[model samples]
Target: MDDDVERAARKVRDVEQAVSEHVTRGGPVTGRASSPDGAVTVVATPGGPPQSVEVSAAALRMGPHGLAAEIMRIADRAQRNANTRLHQTLERVVDPRELTAMGIERGTDDDESGWRR
Candidate 1:
């Protein structure tokens, strides 16, 4: 019994350490997207917010309306990519079975229902 307790405690500590490291290091939970013409590229964080956007000279030639549309499309793709990355990161830190045992639903990061109870 004591051994089991110690093991569980150790596991908890390990998880805490991993989480701390991930936060401190800003884990690789980012998404990237590029326009079909390779004229615009976007990088976003886990919550689908853009961190950086790069527009090529060729893309700028599209004028305001066309450029704006391309930017929006690329940003959307970037957000989706970020969501996928966040989900994968969660999977790495926590076992799905453990989440189920705790009565937490494991859902894709993109699904609002999945992340919630």
Candidate 2:
């Protein structure tokens, strides 16, 4: 019984350390997205602020409100991409059964984003 308890504790510690390192790494996984009009682009990583935002001169023609809206849309797409990548990365390090138990699972053919909760 004591041996089982010790093994479980060690497993928990190892998982915690892996998570910490992954978060601090900033990005081995990244996502990039661009507006359909090529006006705005965004690069992001999961759980982090956007890594970069590029606004082309063409975006100025949209006026301030339209440009803001486009940026928001592109940013959301970029974040979703990052989230999918992050999910894949986590799957490699964490147990698939554990992720399923948490109600996080990969998407099916109907969804390519690779994550659902």
Candidate 3:
């Protein structure tokens, strides 16, 4: 083979090797979130089993309704945290502007300036 073709083939092999190594060695990304009262905390990952939930004894003393609310809040917070991390990870791998230019707006706020949605 010509020098150019040989170099191209080597590059392709290197990329394949890199991808294999990455896939074999990487662990799922995870994030932890805690409630304002610190009574509840949850952990989650994008592509693997979720982390075990933890509730404080003080959280249990809050009564059933309040405890339920706390659980829901914790889940929300955990999912939000996981989503944020996943977005950051994917952003490194993909282009956000591509999604925007494709007219795919996700939880976008109308405020011109940046505002949390």
The best candidate in terms of lDDT: 2
- In order of appearance, the predictions have TM-scores of 0.60, 0.64, 0.55
Candidate 3 lDDT (Cα, whole model)? 0.58
Assess candidate 2 and give its lDDT.
0.72
lDDT of each: 0.69, 0.72, 0.58
In candidate 2, what are the lDDT values of residues 1-117, reduced to their tens digit? 999999999998998789668756744676677876679988876667888899999789999999999988888777677666666667867987786565444433232342222
Task: Count clashing residue pairs in model 2.
Answer: 0
2 versus 3: better TM-score goes to = 2
Residue range with the least summed lDDT across 10 consecutive positions in model 1: 108-117
Candidate 1 structure quality by residue, lDDT tens digits, 49-84: 688889999888999999999999888777666665
Per-residue lDDT value at 24 in model 1: 62
**Residues 1-117 of candidate 3: C-alpha lDDT, one tens digit per residue:** 699999999977875575455534554545566777779877765444457678998888989998888877766556555545545444543466643453322332221221111
Pairs clashing within candidate 3 = none
- In terms of lDDT, which candidate is stronger, 1 or 2? 2
lDDT (Cα) of model 1: 0.69
Q: Which candidate number would show the highest TM-score if scored against the true structure?
A: 2
